[model samples]
Target: MSNISVSENEASSSEPENKNSPAVIEESPELQRASSSTVPPDVPSDEPPDAPDGGWPAWSQVVSAHIANMISWGYGTGFSVFQLYYKQTMNLPAVQVSWIGSVQIFLCFLVGVASGRLSDGGHSRQLYATGAIICIFGMFMTSLTNTYWQILLAQGFCQGIGAGLVFMPASASVAVYFKKNRSFAIAASGCGSSSGAILYPAIVQFLMPSVGFPWAVRICGFISIALAIVGFCLLKPRELHRVPAPYLDLKAFKSLPYSLFTAGSFLVYFSLFTILIYINSFAREILGLGDVKSVEFVLVTNAIAIVARPIFGFLADKFLGPVETFGLNCIALGVMAFGWIGVHERIAMYVYSAFVGFVNGGAQGLFTSAISSFVPDVRKMGTWIGMTLGLCGFATLAGPPTMGAIVDANGGKYLWAQVWAGSTIIIGGTMVLISSRLVLRDSAKPSAI
Candidate 1:
């Protein structure tokens, strides 16, 4: 009787506790609601996270993009030497020789359109590695070419296609890792252009006589191989396959600021490459400078821009703002183009080139930075950048050749061409300025742009 009473008392105590505690959670709606997770309808779970703006991983991408910028811009910088060489040796007309350069630049930007989309789909490494190989192969094959057709296929088609592939993807990679200092990072990457410009001209000028044209080009190829290896090693893609958007983001053109900025970008490229293409020739033919001396001026132009480009970027990030800074640069480039008309004396020409280089280099460095001014979503960066630059390809293709033909038609006088370049750039600057005001007043997050 005592054991039975004890067991029944224990069961009665445990039953009440279990019924009160467990039944509260199971039967009381308020308790059940408190325990379960309930997400608000407005908040999205799949939004992209914010960038880790200043870590080793972030900075490493800048380095890789720098290497990419070096290769892409480096080869273009040395083309003047080849231009002079091909003209003298092959008996080709000046306009015909310039087609090679125009075609090369056109393909670089053209191929970038497709490759940039590929980058958005997370093919950066594959595009980069393949571009490096193809570019290096084109360089080697260029060394063996004796005819214009052969050179055009090897250098213009293959190498230009390769440059287009690598440069955009690497740049797009850098765009993802930064927010606050994006303008600075993008501009800093352009310092690669200065490095390549200096090294390429210096290499050809000093080594061509001793090593011959073939071996000098081969040496550049060797250096390219080394940089390509380093670029592939450092590059890391953070974003994976994005749900595909329209091949052409036609909706982007609906925005007033986007349209104006795109037009400004086009006009600026039209005027900008004129200086790079003809500066050496002007120094050689009009000023009576020898081969080595004229080439030295080209070096001077490239070297000063290295320091100037970064300073422009820093100012855009900290003080002036990117679009505002770009507007100023376009105006300055216009004045520089006009100023070129007055430079006849050798010493005066040297001073003028340094100044022009500073302004022009700053402008090139500002390009991607300025575009970032209006781009709100980081995910769409590769697509937007590609579209803008690819359109600018038409300008680049048409710029140098058109200017060369104008000079040729004007009996070798650069006066008319200079006027056209200056007028177009200043007009472009005005459009950009108007666009800047519209953006600052209307953007929901004005300061972020």
Candidate 2:
């Protein structure tokens, strides 16, 4: 591990003399100079700090991170296939069946603090290696389980924790490597989720009927294993200035922008997974689509995301800036939520899926890059992101089951669920707009809050 350095501009510009005043500084050339200077000492000074931005090492890391993203996020995002399968095969209530997917998402966010802290402490590779093994083991165990509890422990809890460990570190590493094109780099890595989304559902659809559930799941597990190994070899992080504190900075809430941003993230996630989890079921139960056709809804949504991610990333970098882009995308997501109410016919469903998928990909893919802009020191990024995401984890935990209860109470109609999802996302979008205003107002003096 190499020592880290903070440029004079970054060190001097990070803090405000007046505690109550917003730190707004001019967007000077110094800011750009300081950005690359924050890299660890091991990077050669002769080569442009942004060299690896397109160079093989940087792209290789992105590719590995993409693989990890595909394995972790792909499974969680496409859990609808399994959800529909459980509904038909198992004698469980909708609420009980929803727990498996909910728990998987919950642990993925909840473990962020620990995993991020570990990465900040220079344990990134170890965490990724351990996570890969745990995730592979969980998937293999899932294939062997017949009971709900067994699957919950193996697939939901075990795999979720492993995925979190892999994802957080991989995300943090990309920030370390790219400063000028950070959003685009992160977006490129994030496309793996969309790719997984495109491939996994189709794989399950083909495999489940031909080979049955156990083999279908095991085959996915095998694919995850191969990807994880390659990702583990490629993913690397720059050394930190120092190890981060074991505890989360509760004082981070004092920053108005950060507080509001976290709140908005929490609210957005409250209904975020609802569509992904239940869209296939909605098509089958509400729209009268066949099993295969219903699964295609998931495919279409994720497939559109593949193209949308890079476009949004480019827009974030070149025009809107990450915070603005994220807020605007959130608004688009809210509008698309309303579109879901009209999705009765096949054409309407596909249209809604494509629009929502585009917006959702932009919002999610740009999230980490947006947050990174708030940090003054890249060394503490892992801790800040972990704590913020950990707070949002509760929303992921509660959202699905609450929606399940609402659907059950309404006699299986999706009207109330749509209302819940749309209203929360709209509110979340408003919160993000407020945060963006704070960022814009304080743009003159850039302080990593």
Candidate 3:
């Protein structure tokens, strides 16, 4: 492992020590205590101080990170197949079916605070290994269950926790390797989810009738295990003296800009997943498409995302700053949400899915870079990011069920749900614009966030 270090004088002079700013000028005693375990005592300290950002090691880490996203988010987001299956086979209501996905997403985000802290303390590899084992176990257990509660405990809670442990560390590790090309790297990693989205739905769609549901899910589990093994082997952290930070940094919210940004993120996530969960059902129930035809909507959405995410990442890096790009993406998402209201035919729904998928992919891909602009200390990146996502976890957890309840209230009509989704996304986009303005007003460089 290679370690990077900065001199005390350089650290002090680069950024002013402001209490209100989300900047850490010096490692506190607590952080110093935590740093002890991050590095081995026998390792020589005469190496170098900056990462070889474009080297083989850095790129390998990127590849590993991409695999991690594919397994955790790609497979996780494709739960719409299971959502449809549970609705037809088990006679479950939309709300209950929504919980299975929501709980998985919720735990993935909520557990990031702890997982981020662990990564910051140099436990990245251990977290990945443990999560892989637990996730594999959870999937196998899910194959044996027939009841909702059993599925929820096995697939929802167990798998969710495992994914969280893998997700944060893999994601945060990318920052350790890149600076100038950071957005592009993050975007590339995110495409894994899009790839997974394309592959997994098609797999489930093809396999369900032939092999049955239990074996279909188990096959997905086996694929996850293989990917996790690859990720564990290649995802190495850039060795550095890590500053020990609190598991959760409540003080990050003290900055009004950060607080507003977090609130906006919460609202954005609240509506972001509504379409992904219900689009298949919408196509089948409302548009009268068959099962095979309906799953095509999901395939189109994720397939477009593969191209859109990297393009948006490049645009953000070269032209639009991350905050501006993210805000615009959210605005586009809101407008697209409204487009769903007018979609009645298969052609109309397909067009809607393509437009929304592109915009949503851009928004999600740029999210980490947009948030990273706010923090001065890169060491605390995991903790700050964890805090943002942890707060937003509640919204992700509640969004689907609330939308399901609205659909149920309207006797399966989706008009109100569309309205609800569009309105919240627009509101969230407005808050993002406000946060961007504050960032611009406070600093000469808007990218500074």
Best candidate according to lDDT: 3
Global fold similarity of model 1 (TM-score): 0.87
- Give all candidates' CA lDDT scores: 0.76, 0.77, 0.78
Residue 12, candidate 3: how far off, in angstroms? 14
Per-residue lDDT over 1-449 for candidate 2, one digit per residue giving the tens place of the 0 to 100 score: 11223456765555422224464333334233222112222122222243355677777778887887887778888888888888888967767888888888888887878898888788889888887788888888988999999989997999899888888888888877876677888888888888887777778777888998888888988888888888988886765466447648676676677778889988988888888889998998899999999998899899888888889888777666676678778878877877788887998998888888899999888877777656555677788788877877888888888888888899999888888998898898788777866744453343442
Winner by lDDT between candidate 3 and candidate 1: 3
Candidate 3 has its poorest 10 consecutive residues by lDDT at 33-42
Off by over 4 Å in 1: 1-49, 444-449
Q: In candidate 2, which residue ranges exceed 4 Å CA deviation?
A: 1-26, 29-52, 444-449
Q: Which of 1 and 2 is the better model by TM-score?
A: 2
> Least lDDT summed over 10 consecutive residues: which range in candidate 2?
36-45
Q: Candidate 2: RMSD over Cα atoms?
A: 5.4
Indicate the TM-score of model 2: 0.89
Q: List the residue pairs that clash in candidate 2.
A: 24-444, 24-445, 25-444, 25-445, 26-444
